[model samples]
Target: MRSSLHVLYLSLANLLITLSITLPSPVQTAGTVLVRRSDDGMWHPERYGGGAPKVNNPPSPGPALAASTIHPIPSPTLLEATGLIPFSAPLETTHPIPSSLPVEPKEPLRTIKEPEPHESPLISADKFNKAMTAANFPVPSSEQHVAFVASTKKAKITSALEAAMYLAHLLWESHGLQEVVERACVNSACPGSYISDLDVKGKRYFGRGYIQLTWAKNYLEASKGIYEDDRLLQHPEMVSENSTVSWETAAWYWGAKVHDAAASGNFGRTTAEINGPLECRGGWSGAEAARSRFRLFTTIAPIFGAPGPFLEAGCY
Candidate 1:
């Protein structure tokens, strides 16, 4: 009985050992454990604190260890069943968008042309006619004198007309028609002169051109300074026929220098004295003609767009 009891006790002990070896190891769901292989090729628990839990069956031959083992989680997608990430974040796109049509560049702006310098502003013809009539010009009842002057002296009728028109404009701007006529008659050898002895023979020393530019020195200087032609002094009649030359001489004579001098109270007498006896003989007495001529100048200055005071003071 003792022998039989000993055999049964040994069998019971062996059975307990076999059960412990065959049963699955207790695995904590929240913790991890590591198992190492023994010489017999069976896995046995080696680390229990913080290693991967032992698999129920020996892991099947997994893919060979990757050359680069570190990997980031894949982007979330509905197709990946094992993936547990939530809503997809916006993708950081880097690809450029393809365009189907080409864009045209804007055209450059065009520049506008400026108006011509010599062109006159729009003014009423009635105003011009009234002004001319007021100045006693009467708009040439016939073109006879204009034609004669043009033919006899090779002068231009158009030039004379332009000069006359320019003068009429001045007269309208300055004093009345009578004042203009009286002023123009000063020292003038025309049909009307305050003194008969001052009148010369056959249109000699007549107020020839616009501004009645007279005196040899004045002619020479004006021709040279304005027209840049020294020979213009010889053909004094050309001043009436040539609008270009006439206007230039007019500008120089009636412009800033004489204007400034007159404004300063000299009245252009001091400068006239420089021309010798023939130019300034009677002194203040002779100045009457000059003063009269200057009055006409003042009257006509407005036509050329000069101010009244400027004309009065000879300020060009």
Candidate 2:
């Protein structure tokens, strides 16, 4: 009897191990395996001859799903169409099943600010006057306007800002009224001998034109810059006789040397360019003239669409 019992126990142990390997992992609803110590000291499937329900094959994993940022709950219509739930069941209500869907928290929307549009480089004569008035500079005359537009066009002063600054300089120079003819020099005896090379036998070349192209040499140089001619040196009154000649000579000075000063919007620098060393030189008169020019720059800045002539206007 002892030998028989040992054989039966061994057999039972073998069966249990074989059953565990064949079956899938035990799940919550799946029935549990049972055992009984036989009277003969042997074990089989179970006391009543029952075992885990026979499974032909393990369940296959479905196709992999792509990950998503916003996890959308499956709509009831989708589940119904797929026959996931009972056909007799009611459709999805406004309220969702708590366990069926994830609670997606909302995020705030973002926005951005845009910059405002700016003005163009150039403006019309009408607009130019309006801007000058806004800056407290008086409007130019019709004749002054004609001369300004004509001369500046020739000098490549295309922008309204450029025209405005050029007009401002002319205003201060001769108040838009220049004596184009050569006049008496600082000294009566030195009528036209400002430059030794200009002191010709029968010629008088003193201050003339808008900004006054003075000295015999200046007349010669200015005519070359104006129209590439030297007749102005011999007959200097041609600048006064011809309106175009007068404006052209002035434009030549502006485009040649004083253009950069105007670009800076510093009237003092432009003034210094016109009258050497007088801007921040000499005595009281020189100092006063310099101050006045600096102020003019600030005042005319707005006409050119500048924020202001608030930049440093010192001699440098």
Candidate 3:
């Protein structure tokens, strides 16, 4: 009976050991990743975490690893799922992209600089016509005023002093823009030398345009400078016939010869450049003409903002 009891006890112990070895391990679902023990004695992920549903589309296995060292191949989806490379955050209204970028200027830097001392805003038509009237000039039509202003701007004559001197010359020379040609030459009895130009089939280049542009050579040069051709020499009458051309020719002359002198604040120096040989000399006639030029400048200049007691009067 004792031997039989001992045999039963040994059988029970062996059965308990077999049951412990054969029964499965308890499944854990607490962590972020589902893992399993491998033959290599490493815990490897079976599936991603975050309650992701199981699918048949398991990731392909990487190259075989050695016993001790292992590096899991990071698939793009695996990296995203594992929080290694996190998903982009949701866009917010708090921060927005800019609509426009800074742009560089197309013009040269020098061209955009502030106006110089000699520069000023152009005078208005009302002011110009009023100044003309004040200087005993005819109240020029609006069209005439526009033509003159355009011409002056084209020549870059923007200063009040220069415009004052220029208009004075015009007033004296053209008699307030009333006469286009020299009155002395009106009857074709202009001095013989004035008629000596053989060009233009007997068309004389005697004192035409607002400044009374004289000489065939002057007509030719003005034509080249203004029209880029011989139009003025070919047809000198165009200067008188076309009002715009008349004003432009005078502006061209002022810009080329008289601008610097007028800018110097010397009225006599300006007259010397225009008709120095005749008008700048101190004869009775010259003095009278100088006085007239001075008087006209004084009258019209103040209207254009030129301060007076202007002392610069005579060329001599």
* Highest lDDT model number: 3
Per-residue lDDT of candidate 3, residues 75-129 (tens digit): 4454444544432212222333222322336876565677667643476777788
For each candidate in turn, give its C-alpha RMSD to the true structure in angstroms. 21.4, 19.0, 13.7
Better of 2 and 3 by lDDT: 3
Candidate order (lDDT):
3, 2, 1
Sorted by TM-score (best first), the order is 3, 2, 1
lDDT of 2 by residue, 38-151 (tens): 344333232111222222221122122222122233455554455444222122333333333233467766666676775443545665566456546567566656666667
TM-score for model 3? 0.59
Candidate 3, which segments miss by more than 4 Å at Cα?
1-121, 189-191, 195-198
The alpha-carbon deviation from the true structure for residue 98 of candidate 1, after best TM-score superposition, in angstroms, is 3.0
TM-score of each: 0.33, 0.51, 0.59
Assess each prediction's global lDDT (C-alpha) against the native: 0.40, 0.57, 0.69
**Per-residue lDDT value at 261 in model 2:** 73
Put down candidate 1 lDDT per residue, 1-316, tens digits, no spaces. 9999987887676455445554324421112223344455454553222223334433433122212121122322321344332222122223322122223467888788886786432222443444455455555322322322333122121232233333432343223322212245444434543223423234333344444455555666766775577555566556656654544554455452333333343323423422224224557655554455455444434553443343222211
Q: lDDT at 138 for candidate 2?
A: 66
Alpha carbon lDDT at 202, candidate 3: 60
* Model 1 misplaced regions, further than 4 Å: 1-99, 109-130, 139-207, 261-316
Of the pair 1 and 2, which is ahead by lDDT?
2
